[model samples]
Target: MFILPAALAFYRALRVYPSPVELMMIYQKTVPEPIFKIVIELTNLDVKDRVEGYYNKFPPQSLGVKVETRMVGDISKKALVLTKDVQVGEVIYKEFPIVGALDSDLQPKGLYCTQCLREVEPSMSIKSPESPVYEAVYCSQACQSLAKPQHHNLLFTLERPLPPQIPLDEITPEKLEARRKAHTQFADYLKNQAYGHSAPLLVARFIARQVASEMNKLIPGSSGIPSSQDYAGADDEEYLLADHIERLRYVEITPPQEELKLITAVLDTVLPGLDSLVTEERYSTLLGKMAYNAFGVYYDGARDDKPAPTARPEDIERTRTPMGTSRQIGSAVYTVSSYLAHSCDPNARPSFNAGNSQLHLIANRDLKAGEELTVAYVDVAQRQDESVEECRRRRRMELARGWKFACPCERCEREGTTVGSEDEENIGDESRVEKNMQRFESNEGPL
Candidate 1:
């Protein structure tokens, strides 16, 4: 049976320490321990419940998929399995992003709808003239309306950040000017400093969305804006955005201090204490999660004209895309799609057929009912002038560098042994999970 590591760790900590004072010291040593404890307690109501009812609330059957625990060389991991057989080209599920951001270069060009990431004609675009910091153009009034309430007002425009039900201090010209200044500074930073990586912008928008969701709850009969969960067919009220995000694994990242300060200032300016929602540590984790799980948004296959990234190869941000990040027009994070594991020869693929951020997960091949669903996180096809061995090495290296995981899928294994290649002998999966999560998933007792 799966046991939450958070509970196990807390139990062991109590046994080892055996004193309330000692527990306080333990909490001090691990700053996020208290927060994790709360998350686990709130989510994991019992020993049987996993990740605070994540699996229970988002059951696989609801989406034509089931999550199964499998052993990958003694490492217990979750896999999304098909509940029923599916023919090739059939869509298994559709999902929308929690937050999406257009590419930095494209944001200034106003070539796409900022909300849906859809191409917009210059004459037909709806421009946000009130926003002093950012240039946001929507393809339609509906997109503009949704974007403002969702995150645009809080992040870019000088509108009231919270719902009318939430009491606010008397608004003055000086205060409005301050808020405008903060938004401009944050927007400038994104435009100038946050190129190549969309995580900073994505994280900023996500935090704003969370605040919006919370504020809307204070007002009766106000749904604010439809969230990604609504599109995914999940009950939005049953779970907070935090409940979904905290369960996902994150890469280690140290976001620039200035970036955090800028974002905090923007939040704080709109509503005092709003900045507390994103502490430095929390901000880092959020950025890491965005970096690790974001999918590149593209249309009509993808574009070939994305400007060459000036950052070092190691520093350039990569999103999950079989066509490569260069081809994507934007980046987005999805709750369910995040769980689809990687494979060099994947049986499924993500499609944006509507020419927007909504993702349609389609089966790549005829899939059995119990077969695991997989998608290529990186481009895995053999390029012209490249040998099969070369292609394998290239994809493996990309996975290792981008995701910090070595491909151990059947295709990689079969090709590795057949080609007698040993170039990647030193490469191994270096990806990590939160300590408590790792312990729980591994079924290991606490230290």
Candidate 2:
């Protein structure tokens, strides 16, 4: 039996990091209470306190945090408040940490760990046994196993070849209309029977799965559930109806009429005339729900601006900032994440981690105890570099175009200035940032 002082001294002498498993072994073997205390102190944790804290904040298997409603001007808005103070770079929340598998022949090859989205060596990759679209690569077998349960179905579907790439230049009105007709037929097929899976639709399917999972949790005896949309099951039918009504009440807004047309188009393909199955009002409301809450999902190695010119591709691939350095892969609606409202100058930012297919809300700056956490819908990182008028105009235009809201951000309110360009402004000018995003997305493909 080693003395407490001797054990502590031995622990201090070891320069290498110790795994938690090793620490547990040492903890169990330590005879003296003082040596156990030393181990606890070294780990920087009070297990009892941590266990209590977690149970106090959340129910068993429940996600933590609460949504609060507050009045901004005359409108009541929802915001996600932190249950505890988090330090800088600490993740407040993480959701959908994994996404659809990346296509093989994707550029910046083997950039991310298939499991954790951590950068992995190309030499370290292990291929999925028989996957076609995904040459699934992971940091380790453990990661591959962790991803298998949630990702297996999608992976099997990707065993077929991906459709041919569409050129960005060929997105003309005529071409779009033709594709729309073909897509409508495809949607009908999807409605009647499951055949093919597209990346964007896969994201929607993922959201439906999440919604169904949440619904199952809320209901009794819903174990071993298969699928949930309207008419999937009696329990699911009730949940879907109640969920939409609840969403409307939570957001406190009516569905925008303009978005209904897009909804109609989507429903035509996915549900194949299911648009007429539901009431027009109900269908429109669902579209509005999606429009208001959906977030753009991005994956690792999507950003071109992140890597240093001399940085190796592997080094560049590791960058996973909350606001993302790359183009978006797809969009999905989250029940809890949707509570975060938009701010031009945000205190928090959302980062999509593809490893776990989760979105993490990170602190952009030090936050007070009760600060309503806000995230920017538009990238406002360049505000400091640009003029106030330029910032205001850009934000206003973005808000109008993307969010369907006028600029009411603190910066816009404070600046109260606008400038217009006399010449026709080409928004698509091939700037360095634009070029980088295009190159990265074109090479890697969307999430």
Candidate 3:
């Protein structure tokens, strides 16, 4: 057998089970005992590491630095208990706060999908009392489970009573109370089956009110109907005014073209500001929105100098409707998103806002607390017993209205490919000669 070097032999001797003390013994045997004793260190890491775990696990008593245990978002030692925007692709163990994150004033009404926070998809939403509203929630059972623990805490805190989200007497989004009151009236009107109550009265009334409102904006004519009435107007008009009400309709009794032009000029200047006031973020190439609305403050201020450009709530009432088609000009105004509410047939829904201030409603039959309310903006005519093709037709109408192109809704995904930039018409026939001929001959259409 070959003889191994003394140093190698010493290291090999304690190869399997090495305690620090054993390593020191090996050093003493190989090196001079005095030198080994002088240099021997309990401070050496390699020797300590080999035996550390064994001592901690098997020994009855141990002396070491105490490691403090603390609750953390992760298994790792470094962690923070604060809210942060999650990076797109980064993975992390994190938590969120759960407290009265939602308004407790309103009664719990509906449900939503926890995953998407939409109401259209069918899903089970936990039904809790509207009062002692502790939790603002998601659309689905899955969302509840996925919510960070703090989100759960918010729910627990909201377990007390609060006030209504929006008061009936207070001004809300455009036509909010008016629409709500009108809906109540319509519901009451529809309650009666006599005289084809469903035919068109509500729509007719809405249109008439819209028209009258516009007429009232003009300078007063002697007899028929005065064109412009100041904010302090007749009892009928004054009765309709909320503290911040602005007109949406008008009738021109004066036929003063100059005055109309002047009013028009003033409006062009004012409206952009009104719209910009609410914009918190950029809208495509446009500037941010009208700042969060201070109700009708701006609208009211503009009217002090000239005829208000906005339609009167009452004037649209004067117009005639197409036969059997009782159409209303006033739009539906939503309050808190009903993603906070769910329904089998939800009366209220989300209406995505548009550039022109017109909004289209969407339906979210399944929603929960804390979800933005969405409505079915798809056409009502197409909504009835309609096939998917019919629904696509309705969406096509919306596209014509200039809505966002890609539809992430569940229905849109099920249908054929949605239109995109590549589907738009070509700018020019750039291909030449043989290339042009080939392009024509090819079965696939040009992008």
Top of the candidates by lDDT: 1
Model 2 regions more than 4 Å off: 1-64, 97-222, 226-284, 299-301, 305-326, 353-356, 383-385, 418-447
Off by over 4 Å in 3: 1-326, 332-366, 380-387, 400-404, 417-447
Please identify model 1 stretches exceeding 4 Å from their true place.
1-52, 193-195, 221-224, 228-230, 233-235, 417-437, 440-447
Better of 2 and 3 by TM-score: 2
What is candidate 2's CA lDDT for residue 252? 16
Error of 3 at 162 (Å): 38
- Residue 182 lDDT in candidate 3: 35
Candidate 1 vs candidate 3, lDDT winner? 1
Task: Give per-residue CA lDDT, model 2, range 1-447, as digits (tens).
Answer: 445544443233211111234434544564366766665575464333432342133211233355555665544544567666667787776654223333212212566654444556777776665443334567787766544433332223221111122112334465444435544443343333221112233333333333323323322333313321212112232222223222321111243353344334533333233233334444433444444455655655454432223433222211112343234433444545666777777778777654333567788887666777888776565556787667667655554433345545787677764334511232333133234323432332111
Evaluated at residue 282, the lDDT of candidate 1 is 73
Error of 1 at 76 (Å): 1.5
Q: Is candidate 2 or candidate 3 better by lDDT?
A: 2
Give the candidates in order of TM-score, highest first: 1, 2, 3
Clashes of each: 2, 15, 81
- Tens-digit lDDT string for candidate 1 (23-99): 44444465365554653454344333434456656644568886677777766776788888899999988888888
TM-score against native, each model? 0.84, 0.47, 0.21
Taking the tens digit of each residue's C-alpha lDDT, what string does model 3 give over 151-216? 222112221111132112333354333333333333333333222111122222222222223322
Model 2 TM: 0.47
